[model samples]
Target: MRIVLVLEYDGSNYCGWQSQSESCAIQDAVEKALSAIAKEDIRIVTAGRTDAGVHAFYQVVHFDTLTSRPLSAWVRGVNAFLPEDISILWAGEVPDDFHARYSAVERRYLYFLLNQSARPGVHHNKVGWFHVPLELETMQAAGKLLVGEHDFSSFRAAECQAKSPVRTITHLNIVRQGNLVVFDLRANSFLHHMVRNIIGCLVYIGKGKYSADWIDELLQHKNRTFAAPTFSAAGLYLAGVRYDPSWLIPEFSDFPIISNGVLR
Candidate 1:
């Protein structure tokens, strides 16, 4: 019984949340919808790993079952056998040292940027990287010089395997709306693609083309070619995963799948 899942997908049809070897992933479509609702075989474990086309609104996973269903049969039996861009926005029973990726302490990400100049007829594939005319207060003052603790080897990912590129960045906002420019990171951990190479150098420092002192000389030169091009994962999102309140559970944030994706 370990259970804990919250998922929401549509990374434009898979190949992201881990488990790959040639595409088609979302952990192999939520482990084949939790192995057809616990008929057996299940293997889930996440709280991170979102690459190919990246997207999630509150991804978290965990597994271990012996049947006994109910939690609304693991959320209406894994959203009735998953598919239409994945669903299953809830499930419970956690705390055996709860860990949807090492008892995650913090991890949030938002990275969107739709500058405007037309081209988002209908939320254009969930927003991000539309370019032209960005200067939301100098991209929010270079995202407040990348808030807090750092070592982010120039925004990581050059085959990042993360054994330490150091990290802390508690938050880094950069907001805007008409033509959207979002950004919203938060961290305690992150390496691979590190928020799309720190929004490709915060969109080259919000389009004056780099210089918040080139992010303190690329974090004092840890290097990744001083970063500036890993932006569009179609507006990345995984937006949540902070655990520690005795690994919460009772009315876990008033449940509704813990406000699943914060109201879309």
Candidate 2:
């Protein structure tokens, strides 16, 4: 049967999602749990691979098994073997044709920032930091610039392997609550470092370093070097993945949550 597992993890301790020869990873940890339960080597194919120190709230992975394990067995079994940092939030039977990565119609990410002179407290590890106070309203206004189909060469990693630079930003809502400035962005897909790069540019705008009009010039140039430095990965999170509602797990259907995507 083909099964989909919803995952969440803190990416602070390990490398990216994919396992490497050097260090531990979120995939490696989840694979280990599956191996222990399935009593055979198992691997998970994720919806997307997050970079090191990046977090996820609703990451999805699909795997197959011949074992006739109960749904609870899939969930409890995997969770029992998993470490504190890596967790299997839920597991459900998905259609054979359903793929965790490709089937996703939309993927959303949130990059958090606490705009203040002082450092963050408990939530600091999960959010990005800015030393200078920013104009939240201006930043919110600037976010509108990125909401449309455009070639995002200026906002992607130079090493990005994606064939096309064109992508659609369905939503880009920047809102301020207290001292926290949250960037909510959703799209059909993303290029490498797209959100971080966008955030960097937006941050500069808030700091009065870049004018709202500058965005058009940057987009037209399509130069990666023209963008500000990519912001810290720590502040970013896979906020959610929206799939067909019919595939929802019975118990975890209502509350949407997942891992921190951190290594520790």
Candidate 3:
């Protein structure tokens, strides 16, 4: 049977989502736990792969196992074998035809930028910090230019393996809540480092280094070198992924990470 699981994790501890040969990745930890529970080899597929130091609010993965255990065993039992930084939120059995990555219709990422003079103390790796006071309205204006479908090559990473640089960004909004600058982005999909690269450009604009028109120029150029450097991954999150309701994946918005980052 095919099992789908929603996971929440503090990526601060592991080496991204993909398993490494040394087994230091979040995927390695998860597979290890699943293997212990199923008493068999277990490999899983994810909806998306997050980079090192990136967190996930609702990461979806699926694995096929002949060991027929209850869904609760997948959640509570598997979590027992996993470390404190990772937890399985929900598990459901799905049709064998369902795929975690291919079936995804949209992906959303949230970048939490702590805009303050002093660095974060307790929330060290939990946020990206810009010491300078940023202009919210200016960043908001620049962010709007990036909305809609376009070639996002400028915002892609050099090592990105995506076959096409074209992506349709359905939403891009930057809002400030107190001292926190929240960047919310939704796209059919994103190239590697796309959100972080775009965040860096928006931060440059927010700090008076560039104007809103710079985004348009970058988009027209379709060159990665023309854009700002990729921002820190510490603040990035694979916040959510959407699939067809017919798949019957359970909702997990009740998790605080889904509502907002550490600070809410």
Which candidate number would show the highest lDDT if scored against the true structure?
3
Question: Candidate 1 on 1-264: residue-level lDDT in tens?
Answer: 788877778696676778887648889878888888889899888878888778776778888888878788888877888887878777888756687888888888776667877777676667775547866777677777778888888888788887888888888877675666677788887889878888878777777887566787888898988678777787787877877767563323443532323333
Error of 2 at 68 (Å): 1.6
Each prediction's Cα lDDT score?
0.76, 0.83, 0.91
lDDT per residue as tens, model 3, 30-96: 9999999999999999999999999988899999999999989999999999999999999999999
Off by over 4 Å in 1: 3-8, 11-36, 39-58, 68-80, 87-95, 122-125, 128-132, 140-142, 149-168, 171-184, 188-236, 239-264
Q: How accurate locally is residue 72 in candidate 1, as Cα lDDT from 0 to 100?
A: 87
Give the better candidate number (1 or 2) by lDDT: 2
Assess the local accuracy of residue 51 in candidate 1 as a C-alpha lDDT between 0 and 100. 81
User: Arrange candidates by lDDT, highest first: which order?
Assistant: 3, 2, 1
lDDT of 2: 0.83
**Model 3 misplacement above 4 A:** 252-262
Error of 2 at 114 (Å): 1.3
Q: What would you estimate as the lDDT of candidate 1?
A: 0.76
Tens digits of per-residue lDDT for model 2, 126-180: 8899989898778877788889999999999989999999999999988776777
Where model 2 places Cα greater than 4 Å from the true spot, the runs are 249-253, 256-264
TM-score for each model: 0.37, 0.93, 0.97
By TM-score: ranked, best first: 3, 2, 1
